[model samples]
Target: MAVSNVPKYHIAMFPWFAMGHMTPLLHLANEIAKRGHTITYFMPRKAQLKLQHLNLYPDLITFHTITIPHIDGLPPGTEIATEIPISLCPLLVETSDLTQDQIELAFRANKPNFVVHDNAHWMPRLAKQLGIKSICYDVVSAATLALVFVPGRNFPKDRPITEEDLSQLPPGYPSSKVVFRGHEIRPLMMITMPMGKNITFYERMVKAKKDSDAIAIRTCEELEGKLCEYMVAQYKKPVLFTGPVLSAEDMKTPLEDRWDKWLGGLNPGSVVYCSFGSEFILEKDQFEELVFGFEVTGLPFLIALKTPRGCATIEEALPEGFEERVKGRGVVYGGWVQQPLILKHPSVGCFVSHCGASSMWESLMSDCQIVLVPQLIDQVLNTRQLAEELEVAVEVKREENGWFTKESLSNAIKSVMDSDSEVGVKVKNNHAKWKEILGKPEFMSGYADRFVQNLHDLVK
Candidate 1:
């Protein structure tokens, strides 16, 4: 706390109000704090509560709460921490001026040398008003940005992903999934390319690509070189391929004694860990597919179901005889799971995920084979890239509806478990590489240092 001992280079981080966004930014902030810089993370108070709920290391960084004005259009009681639909996200932008004012006041009071802003935030405008250098923090990979944005000759004259092109690979695209859960194909990819479309998300990305001082991506060149190159050429900004930002303790081994007690009678690898993140509830038909899938997969499954439909509750969501059929093997929780710990368990050999970047990172970090089941937004694209390009994961189904029959689900799990299969080996290798990449304490520290130094330079 001494004046000289305080060191230099104060930075501010503002991320989208999603757990995926907050997790990495918090990890980065903690890293910067360790390097003797001050970081005041700006976010809604509810987000701060979520961090506290997770028992995050609060002593390492400071939280500057920004009260979100209640917008008329948003549904009642929708906390800022919950997911806002893409259609509603634009309202946040319209209200950007007000958020900007709050941010500027915080800036005037704290005078951050630089600010790292989420891709969705009205960052460039906010930074210009504050006269502080701003960096775009992309929570997803750069390759994804490029693939989504980079226009192709086949691209429609107008529209977002004009035609069905889900099966079509990127130019010199790496090995990505051709099919998922039976013969279902991704219908969303057939639309116009993601970048050229004037949708709010695309416009924000374009603005950030054209005007941001620098862009930081949550991926490494080692894992994705071609995608990184595409981003560099298209964005025309200094691309900082900041490695995946994650904390070691994220994999808190639930007390060995407690975990053992919890699983006292179950066979090892008997429990299926099902979580669809804080958001993303299943529709009725989709929920039924899930019910049958778990039954057909013939594995002991634990499902956490949530949705806008009344199905979010367990008894309401579970089909008749679902519990009776699965019996002791089935445990349904209505809310979130400790994902990091669940993925790391010896019983957890496979992860059914929406392939959000955080979930993907956590699953790979845990060295588990993943069955990707992306629901909305960039997830379909991410799932495609992970399964096809990376070859480490498998897609649950190609349809955007997230509709997979019980038979497909059973086969997907079987394929994932067939230890001798090529895909399975590649998955294991990819998981091993991920473990090697992130498991190194020194390597993680280096990323922390580079991120801090880069921000310091931006401020200077």
Candidate 2:
């Protein structure tokens, strides 16, 4: 742990072109940089802009931008996956692959000691050709990784995963009997590449695992101990847990921000903060149901929704008179907000979230109890961890056919926020316990040091 004793490495970082993926890599990069390792963070030009607000080490970390190649059917200016529809993600992957040459040139110039990459499946091969160590970094829950790597899943290459397939526990997974419903699996199946390519998402994941020197995941042993053990045994490789990587700065509220001013006026733990991450574009009906659900709760709330592409305004997408009816108690913003600051606010009691890993960690690091309403890939799996395994959240009830109604959403919110309810009290207590653990600087710093030490061993 001594600064002089620790080896200083030149590490290259490449993350999948998504905010969820990039943000965690940034956290890891900062952690590594603090250890005196030099880092070359590679990302698309537009994607690099997202990190401008953060305070990163100037001497130890450098940003290397790659020009995204043009691909047909993809929007001209789209550089990240969240900027486009989920259906166009395969095109994004293809276009990103075209940048391999530029990345190679940079790698050759710098000659990094090792490379850390997310689901950009081809990275391992490129690292091998360059004679450097390759580390596969996952930004999702261990259960999702376990399920994806389960023997015989045949994910994207086979016929679409059926309801029956999801209902059964994946073979060879450790004692946890996690089962997915059809609705949960549907979005994952939708993210496939063109058929003839011979490389499905499942294959890509397998290839990354097979080719990497080791794996690093964005979770703690305390959170997913069993799945973490299983991943190591199944892959027969060194698996390092990087803990939650939750920043202490997230606890600070920005001065004079509009949302901060509004939150300041409310009573402590009296507001509900609702947000479905950037990637999930809600259908009109789904959006209406959620709005009605929030209305029924009759609690002070703030909802941040991204306007889908081609949608001119949030008002056009929302129900008529929705804002007027809840004028004093509720506010809706069309685009992004400082989510972590809002989560840490004293007035926020509950977070109705999409269960994205980033949001889950942020909520866990805050005082707010979680109400799960997962929308896309791996989110449902994360919901299982929060609602079932950890007992720190309440999942909205859906019909047998997997349809959730406004009534269900309202009830779910109340079940977590209602002071008189036993479930509500337990969920809040569990969230508090987790927040205490994740907020400890020593705990997070230890994990980050272990992660770097493991990378050092891999390269040696």
Candidate 3:
């Protein structure tokens, strides 16, 4: 098919505030910009800072910051998209309340050839009223999307997870792991993380699914073809997997040099990388368990500690002399670090993660052995699939309080770093193959162009 010679389009790309969502959508916008489309990327100020740090300047892309009028109970500069809790519950409600107004006016004023918005955002409902095209962008995995949209067949819920439960995976895929459509999984889970419980938000998601023009997820069918089929069959929308939209163009400081330095200072494969992405807010007990686990693990690790000031109850959670004993051996930095770089580093042999889709993909693509430290939603399921099913990662044991203790954390870390361990060797080997598959140039850009072409067809 020949490329269209139509006039340039004004496109609005809106993503929910989390790093996982913002990073990929920005990549999509850059691709659209390269195609001569003018993009107005709408997000909050905090999100703007993150984008700016990535060198995505206003001159490069127009940024429309959402302004809330007469909103009480909101701190100043709180834009709903960026400020919503990491849990799907609050995010669904806050984004709906926050994006509804801006979405209405932005679509009306720009008369966009199409409005590309996050599935969590409010554009789907307003698209028809504003006489514009809109598409739901899933920032999570296609396998996850499949799990949510395709309802799980009735299985005896006698146990938390039985062999019968695992056998119901989408067809054409191995039934070794239980995978459901992404939409169907959200409502059933105990939603907790950045903010605790809100059941009403799930109800809104059901309605939003019915109102959208189309849906797209941040994945590739080549990577998850069977699951993608399930999503399309269930949603009855054109669900395109656009692959991971990570620009390979000088993302940050090269990891090789940093890894060499970190290795020169330590033994080979000695350092562990611990990060939970930006969404998890650890409670005091949970924080203590992690720190205690690190102390017990007796391995050099780089941990990102993002506990808010009040959440400094982590000090109380740690074992006595925990920080002092690990001085210079274990490094802990507050706020964010470049995770992909950390994972790709040679010194870092293992990742203890929350299993967010982006981090999971990055870990796989970077050849980093993983130890799953899942918190909520599809993470526990993903952990099971990666560890128990794929044998590419290890799952940390959890307690009844829903937090994995320091003992389990330490043991998992030690096991992964143990060169003699069969599981460790298996993970290392599997990661190499994952990296090889993800490194294919066609996997990145070729599929992306196909996705954009699909969007162009709908608009034209």
Query: Pairs clashing in candidate 2?
Result: none
Candidate number with greatest lDDT: 2
* Residue 162 alpha-carbon offset, candidate 2, angstroms: 1.7
TM-score of model 3 relative to the true fold? 0.83
Residue 130, candidate 3: Cα error in Å is 3.1
Question: Lowest summed lDDT over 10 consecutive residues: which window, candidate 2?
Answer: 190-199
- The TM-scores, one per candidate, come to 0.85, 0.95, 0.83
Residue 425 lDDT, candidate 1, scale 0-100: 79
Better of 2 and 3 by TM-score: 2
Report the Cα lDDT for residue 218, model 1. Answer: 85
Candidate 1 ranges beyond 4 A from true positions: 1-7, 53-60, 81-87, 92-97, 150-160, 163-199, 252-260, 398-402, 420-426
Best by TM-score: 2
lDDT of each: 0.67, 0.81, 0.65
Question: Model 3 misses residue 131 by how many Å?
Answer: 3.1
